[model samples]
Target chain A: MRWKHSDYTGWGRVHRASGELARPERAAALSELTKDETAPAIGMRRSYGDACLNDNGRAIDMSRLDRVLEFDPDSGVIHVEAGAQIGHLLKTFAPKSWLPPVLPGTGFATVGGCIAMDVHGKNHHGAGSFGQHVTEITLVTPKGEQIVTPKKHPELFKATIGGLGQTGPILSARFPLLKAKGDVMVVTERRVADWESFIGLLDTSEATYSVGWIDATARGAALGRGILEEAETGGGLVKPAKRGKKIPLNAPGFALAPPVVRAFNATYWRRVPDRGRTSVKPIDDFFFPLDKIHDWNKLYGKNGFHQFQCVVPLSSVDALRAILEKIANSGLASPLAVLKRMGPGRGGYMSFPMEGYTLAVDFPNKARAEQVIRELENMTVAADGRVYLAKDALASAANIRAMYPEHDKWLSAVTKADPDRAYETDLTRRLKLRDPA
Target chain B: MTPTWIILGATSTIARAFARLVAERGENLLLAGRDMAELNRTAADCINHGAPSAEAIAFDARDMASFAPILDKATATEGAINVAVFVGSMPTQDEIDGDPALIAGTITDSFTGPAQFLTLLAPLMEDRGKGAVVGVGSVAGDRGRLGNYVYGASKAGFHTYLSGLRNRLGRSGVHVVTVKPGTVDTAMTWGMDGLPFLAQPDKIASDIMRAVDKKKNVIYTPFIWWPVMTVIKSIPEAIFKKLKI
Candidate 1:
């Protein structure tokens, strides 16, 4: 395997890593590479923070190893390389009435990434986290490869899922696909007047998939105002999604200035009528709306951006509202803010899901924006909520440890799996997750 | 009737991309490669993509004995039988210079092996009288450069062989496409830097499919390589020998 020196960053682009990357095209090559020296495995690098970054270290790029190894139509079980993209799987299987049980905000997030983060989707209220549906995982450590299942190696399986890839490189996985009506989605979009109604709508939602687009710049009476989208799979004929357009150059810093973001959010909120409207859309359009604008992160300009995401318990709705109000008052939030309801279902000790409301907001990498995110992180910890490691870039190590009560359990399992810390990444090191301090 | 595509070196990036394209068009696929595990995964991927049927067959470009079973499997199926050759090996010029004996293996892998296999399959394809054979060569074959002359010479030989095969196969209504691709983003060129006009495997696969549909005898992928190679070929040999590319 040839190791290429490369400089890469996460999806947010705020944190960067200059490292040596080895991309093996076959499973045998991947096994051979990991047989002696193990490195952190990265797929598509879709995480918003440093989860996929390994500064001055070696990382194995698993993108080339993506391929469906086997599929049983009768049981809907699929054995696939860890690098397979969630969107590609949905596109290939939706036509046959099958879909991945959980899809993150972007289709580009690989199955391995989803498992590593235990990501949830709009259907989290029903389908649970991504790792919940995994039947088995093949993990490659420095020693060799081992097949891990929930029943055979329950603790190892839990540690591998949402374990921040500290255990080892996930080689492949077996998971059952969800049955879908068709490739298209019937979506209903409605406007929420304020924070109260938005939370009410989310709580009362009965749809299989539901999510809210929050207007973070709104204040006073319009605080937390946004659009609520509920969708279900339906058989229909629709035009194929257009090829994504690329953002050729970085925008000027003024592109996402507060005034501009407020204006854009106002217009976006107004796009949905007050009474709401229903439409038919390609599944991708509804799930990954931002993906249509390729490299949309460039809009944040050269310095890059950060996404602050956290989930709070149902009883902490007041704390969540206080956090939203703080964000609106700061006027530093980008237009890319989201609100969703999550279930208690989770597959790992480190998995970041609970029965609550989750909020995510993007901010350009500025001193003021970072300050606001820090404040938000403190508020989340005080509310007994956990900030998503996948999107966090500035949370304190102590705060992170305090949020996940079972951190010690995960650390012990990870230590047993990778005693030498061969799979340690920038995030794990920065957070001191394995230090046991 | 749906055609059955016999893809040699199916584990290769370009061949896998081509298999996916044809599979999506509802063709049957016989993925031939040395690594049965990798080839089986690719076959399953093709089936998932929409192929009516897909199977992996063991094949080694350097082993003549491994070629017959693939042809037999292809002939067993009715209707048109297509074959796409994407088998070739290139060790760095420095490695080849260290061990001159490497030249023989390179020649067999890139040129003579596929040539002999095609020579054996030609009669069967002519009898069927309906098929296309895609032989992927390289732009390096146009002119020997300071960097990789041995690999270039092998591809040059393959280009000449395909040209003659095209002449013989066209008479029986079987089209032959000689593909000369420039640098591609595959495992072979993963770490190499400063590669000009680097094309993706999907784009090359699509170009190959278009050439087959149009029955083009010789073509350069990404189109720009044709002009680029033309200028390089026009350069006098003395100047070329002194300069490094």
Candidate 2:
């Protein structure tokens, strides 16, 4: 197989790498490539950081090998190649009253990416992380093709999920599908007046899917003000969605300026009536709202942006508030900000979920914003919270070690799987995850 | 009546995408290819995607013995039997230059072998009095160039054969779509440099589906290839030979 010399970046575009990449379309081809030259496998590059990048080295692009291997309607179990997109599965199976057990904010996240990060969804509080539903995984290492399951190789399975492709290149995975009523979502949107109401609404909500869009720019009395959305799968016929529009090019520097973002957030928060409103939408609209506008990241311009996502424990709400206050006063926050409540359901040693409230806020890749993000990370550590590796382009190795208590276990397992450090990616090297302090 | 598509080279990226599209429409499938294991995996995928029934059968372009079993199975299926030929081989120009004997194998895989199998299957479609045959050719066939001329020539021959086949089958209610994709991002063109407007395999498959739906005689995928190929074909041979593109 021939490798193409190319430059690639994660969804955040804050970090980039120039490397030789090979995209194999068949399982056999993938095996051969990995055997010849051990390298990390990448899919969709949806992780908003350097986790998927390997600078000055070789990597394998797994997107071309996407295919469904098996499905049993009786048991609602399906096997799929690692590169298959979550959205594609939802699109194909939703009409048949089936859906993936867990879906991240973006449906474009590939199965491999979901497993590597052990991603969560709005329904995480109820459904757990993506890896919890996985029955088995086919990993292609330099050694050979190894089929490991939760039962057959529990240690390896845990290490592989949230292991960030250090164990091997995930070729395929089998997971149980969640049954759904239909392909549309019935969503209830309500206005959260302040931080207290926002957390209150999330605490009391019984819906299967819930998420909050926090306005990081809101200050003082309106701090933490946002829109809370709760949704459940429902059956109904609605008008077909118009073709989604695309962002043709990067917007000017002032497009996401502070004043404009503040005004936009206020308008968006009030779009629902004072009493709140309920509406029906196609499943994709609810699950991957930003996907409709392809390359919407360009809205931040060529410099790109950084997403700082951290989860703080329930008892540490004050620390979380302090972090938000820092962000609000910094004036570096962008329009894209999200807050969610997570349950104590995680699959792997390094999985990000915890019984806490998680906040993810995006900022333009400016020096001041990076400094603010560093301060937030420190506060999170002080609060005994953890920052998500999938969204971190800026975090110190010491801080990350403090965040993930199971670092020793993950490090040992990954070392045994890849002793040569062949699969180490940009994120791993920068954070020194594979080595002891 | 549901169409049962017999896809040659079932494991090819474009073929796999096409099978999914047909499966979503609740069609039946008989996937034929050399790699039975790979083909079987795709067959199962098609079934899960929504095909009424799907089975994998062994097929070898160089071996004629594999043809009869596939023909018999497709004939037994109770529906309009459509055939899509995505079977072709392209060795690098340098490799062919090194071993002239490789030329014969290339021609057999790209032209004579698929044409022979299609010739046998034509009668079944003619007897049924309704079906479609999608022959995947390439824009490289439009004019012989410095790179991959032998493979291009074979496709050119296949294109002519498809034209004649279309003329013969049109009266019998069978439609034929000749697809000439410029540069599809498949295993075949994975790392080739200087490829313009390289389209994904799914995009090319969707274009083929649209052409087959409209019963178009000939098409260039991405539509832009139509004008681009026109310019390439119209270029003066003497000057074109000196200019490396």
Cα RMSD of predicted structure 1: 1.3
The C-alpha lDDT values of all candidates are 0.93, 0.92
Residue B135, candidate 1: Cα error in Å is 0.7
Those runs of model 2 whose alpha carbons end farther than 4 Å from true positions after fitting are B238-242
The prediction achieving the highest DockQ against the true structure is 1
Q: Model 2: per-residue lDDT, tens digit, A1-437?
A: 88999989999888999999999987888888887899999999989899999999999999977788999999999999999999999999999889999999898889999999999999999999999999899999877899999898888889998889899899999999999989899999988889989988888999999999998999999999999999999998987576568888888999999899988888888888889999999998999999888888889988899999999999998899899999999998987889999989899989999999999999998999889999999999999999999999999999999999988998888888889999999999999999965
lDDT leader: 1
Q: What is the DockQ score of candidate 1, to 2 decimals?
A: 0.79
Interface RMSD of every predicted model, in angstroms: 1.0, 0.9
Flag regions of model 1 displaced more than 4 Å: none
